[model samples]
Target: MRKRRTAYLSGLLALTVLSGCGSSGHSSKPSASPTAAVSWKFTTLDLGIPDKVLKAPVTGKVPDDKTLHVGVTLKVSDEAWKKFGHGKSPAQRAGDVGKDLGITDAQLQKVQAYLNQAHIQAKTSKTRTSVTFDVKAGQAAKLLRTSFVTHKLNGRTYFTPDPNHPPQIPEQIKPYILAVTGLESYSVAPKARALGASAPGRALPTRAGRCIQRFPQKFASSQRVAAAYGFNQLWGQGWRGENMTVNLVEMDGYDRNDVANYVACTGAHIQLGNVNLGATEPAVGAEATLDIQMLAGLAPNLRIVDYQEDPELLNSGNGADSWAALNNALQRIIDDNADKKRPGSIVSISMGGPEGFLSQPIMQAIDQSLRILTATEQMSVFISSGDCGAFADRQYGSLDVSFPASSPYAVSVGGTRLDLAPNGARTGEVVWSDRSSLSRCENQWGSGGGVSKVFQRPSYQQAPGADNRYAASGGRQVPDISAAAINLPIYFRGNWVSSGGTSAAAPIWAAGMALVNQGLLARAHIFCYGPDTFYHALSAGAANRPYTDVVAGNNLYYPATAGFDLSTGLGSPNLPAFFNTLAANPG
Candidate 1:
């Protein structure tokens, strides 16, 4: 969601008008309901596209030969999801998690048999709670009783099932099915939330002090920004993120040379690792390097793992392949920690798409996974709110936030511009909205924050001062926290280039969380604090002072306020204060 955007308001308006006319040249009417001979009665499974997406202009028919990856999420009742979290440890809880969940072995076998009869290659996850498989687009459309077509919206292409016709499943299996994913794919994949003028054809600013000339903003060194946010306070107290591990969920690959250069420049000792879940290592990019180097500069002595997603799955031809890939990586993280009996690790994700850009089923599946990670698995997950301010879908002045950042389970990190004195003390900070000649909006390239259409406000938001004025009735507001995002320098490729986005903000919080976890583990022998704990602690007395309230500026549509607001949520953190507060009330 951090990739530079082109104005698409006019095209989107036209597409919205044209799509309501009728089908876009492909007829995929099923011969019969459920479309196959089965022992049980069937019912329609409504995985309807969001109104914003369903109205997009159809560009063409999906190619029949393109292979589609599909994931079927089996139902685990709310009671079971809550009951499974009662164990003493995450591993102990997971030991019976699959068994306690509703999906029986016989039920899984029945589903597998159905797929085998159709000759589709499929396999269930280790938990036996979900099944994943690959099938041709034509055959999938036939089996799902729908049509596959390509649509163009906001200068990006997406392949999806027909909104007019919903998919059908057996009534017997319907009770066990939560949702399905990978039926919709982005041709232009979601991007990492890092900004820079180093991209090809972008002209650097003529100003000598500006770091990334394309944006022409004055850059702040990573060390200076860290100091302003209280990293020095934590370090002085002997908490340099030791014995902490953070997994960075990334869509692109990074370069080791750049990581090395950044570490050398920052003089931080850290361990680095990578887990490629079928993704190809493309040429080095700014986003991945920026994420790693930012952590390196701040955490000093932490373990970082880059979980890379597949490139093929990110293309237009692969329907929702990127989404499937993300799910797989998430499940792997849970399984790895559980199988090894390791403590819950922090997860940092800097990539996301607007909630409306994705279908309902896709968001539900991802949110379900996040719920397990934060609620059941006890891991702290932080994600970038986005780089498009309130206009995530590129609708100009319209408002929208990104997901899974908007998922109630995630800590949505927003962006801010920090002004530091010569002594590296904080002078002023505001919502990050920078507009130069190359910008598209009056408030271009600001932090992404707004109300979520898909998710309801979570229990934690019920805390005093967490509610926002712009949130719709029962809607979720973002972001949960803010950080210095603008003018942050990172060693990319061969040089120390700088840019700003919620991308930097996410890792900054992740690094801070790692240190906080180390302190908690040392004192209370606890793995990691849950989202609810942080919410309750920060919401309590003013004596704690865990965060510095950001009460200035706006993300186009939402303005910052005295307490919680859509722009900066609880504002930027005071790390030592935050850790001390958590130590006092270690939930």
Candidate 2:
């Protein structure tokens, strides 16, 4: 009997505080019970300020100077922004990314002067990319080059700018202000959970195989991922992400006890890199723990930077009230590695909400940020597509995808279920689309994917067959790639657990990318690789090997195909072959 997170999330998200908090491995509530996933947080947690409070600022029409609040991002200069586009390695990259990009003293003074003129008080970040200021509706209306108005979405009222025109700044400050964010008053939270599900029974094994790592007798561990994906061969090469760094963007806090326990169990050679993106939460569950442990198990020596942000900011758009928290975290990473073209290799974001909830301007803003990281800084963000599958919001019942994943700049990771024989040999893999027809289960969760309504088809995706036969017209495709995502065992918080979702697929890809970066850096002095190189390599492989074609299963809306399909794009990674190819000719 396994516990699932969906059940608890369905009941307003209760949580149990860890006893002796910092001691690590001290959970006040024992999870040894079979139904540990049940909401046993000791007390019911109020979700805080209701959605109606978000609509409080919306006053009839024109807003007062005191009531009108706006969020701003003082971005880099044009030249500094352009530097990230080149394919040079971090060492070869010129200039310190943050300092050069930060608002010059002269520019800051001018902004401060302008704020005084507008009677606005704003806070600036150390990096100067994220700014939070309050201004009269009149001032904000002029700066954004647009006016604010009340809008109705899903029977809810929120404040937003007109859709006809994009935001703009006066010519004098245009050079310094990369973008104007935080226009929306309210934010929408993403409904996703790090839940686990299992099929009825295991399939028959072919050739004898062994589990990846031994676990306690009480819990079951399968090495099908090891035997099937060829992680064994990569591990054998000692390419254990020794020098690479994987920055993970997590929505919730993590349990250090889980990290210590995972390390003790798997002998992972690493510690924690904690970067607080927002105020700390009271208690955390398996999400962060699984992300860290999985990456450590796959690439034990890889340096990890956990960018912990306020989960409230998640699913919030650039203009939304809590938007700056997320933007601040991403920009910090870009600036920290600004010393080089690609200071970091991969960043995994296992959290995202339905794309429909995000405003067009907000989504566009996030897309630009991600593009800067990948196209310019040489980083690939592996984002979990979402666990809600095609119908991100079951209440709406529309085939919508998730944000960040839908962003063309990210490598959206979908899910799959691998069937292994008793011998540990993999028989085949199918989309991890488990909509239980049996009694007692009503969850319609799997992989989130579909043609994006916000983003257009990027040049990298314009290639023939990039869009499947059923591909939606006039939009970008999701899940550029996929991995084994279902019913995998993860060691966390001093206990063994089984879970699956695109959350599992994301880190696996991040680890693989780390391996690729390690290999590329080993052979060349400075390396510049992007989706173009990665996509071209997919077609360049001998008979297009290295990636197993997942022609079975569907995500309720999109089906898997031979080449690239919405379900599992380009299929799962085939190890050394992928890394070798990406390294040898990273054109």
For model 1, residues 1-587, the per-residue Cα lDDT tens digits are 00000111110010010001110111122233242456856578766555666679988888888887787877777777665443245434646555665478677656665565557756555555557777898888776778888788777677777777766666767778778887776522455787872554333233333233322235566667667778878777676766677888777777777676657656677787777766455546677777887888788887787777665555545435777778767766655554344364788988887776677677777787777666555677899998888888656676677888999888899999887665655788898875443245322468889888888887777544565456547788889899988777665665556556899899999998888776666666664445555566675535978888888998877888887878788889787788787667654
Residue 525 of model 2 has an lDDT of 44
Model 1: how far residue 335 lies from native, Å = 2.6
Estimate the overall C-alpha local distance difference test score of candidate 2: 0.61
Residue-level lDDT for 207 in candidate 2: 23
The global C-alpha lDDT for each of the candidates, from Candidate 1 onward, is 0.69, 0.61
- The candidate that wins on lDDT is 1
Q: Roughly what TM-score does model 2 have, to 2 decimal places? A: 0.76
| Cα-based TM-score, every candidate | 0.85, 0.76
- Candidate number achieving the greatest TM-score relative to the actual structure: 1
Error of 2 at 283 (Å): 2.6
